[model samples]
Target: MLKPGGILLLTTHGDITRQNLLPDEQQKFDAGELVVRGNVKEGHRMYTAYHPVKYMNTLFDHKVTVLKHKAGTRQSWGLEQDLWLLQKGNS
Candidate 1:
């Protein structure tokens, strides 16, 4: 577990990826759910886990202070991801 006041930074598939999700996956994502495709290799482009903003908020809400949330441009071979900067807190 992270120490209190510790910082955590990470990125996740976002807008650009969302545009390519299947219809059902898109529906679930729009409903604030984490969409994970587990059939392929973990780090492969086809096996990504799309993280929506609403879902992420509920996932880390009250546990960490959101320092920054930035949606990157097309950087991963025309695929973009979102970056999050958070600080652990006493919740």
Candidate 2:
């Protein structure tokens, strides 16, 4: 639940779909066959969803009034990420 003037912020990663992976990434996928196969990574979660910017718009369209959208690098992992601030729309 949110108040009328409350803010909602979301921070998430970029496209992680198979279509977004590069050729070099495909090679890494093949290279990891033996050592990393079927094994979980050190810090990564079990389940994750990689949504594109377009999908974000689709998901939040008409549901919220976007106040600000920003993209920047994460200092911890040095990975790029997206930040969205939105307010719930009136019914």
Q: Model 2: per-residue lDDT, tens digit, 9-66? A: 9875543332334566445433432112222457765544444566677777877888
Tell me the spans in candidate 1 whose CA falls farther than 4 Å from its real position. 40-46
| Highest TM-score against the true fold, candidate | 1
TM-scores, each model vs. reference: 0.83, 0.57
Relative to the true structure, candidate 2 reaches a TM of 0.57
Span of 10 residues, lowest total lDDT, candidate 1: 39-48
Error of 1 at 79 (Å): 1.6
Q: Provide the overall lDDT of each model, using Cα atoms, as 2-decimal numbers.
A: 0.85, 0.59
Candidate 1: lDDT over CA atoms?
Answer: 0.85
User: Highest lDDT, which number?
Assistant: 1
Q: Which pairs, if any, clash in model 2?
A: none
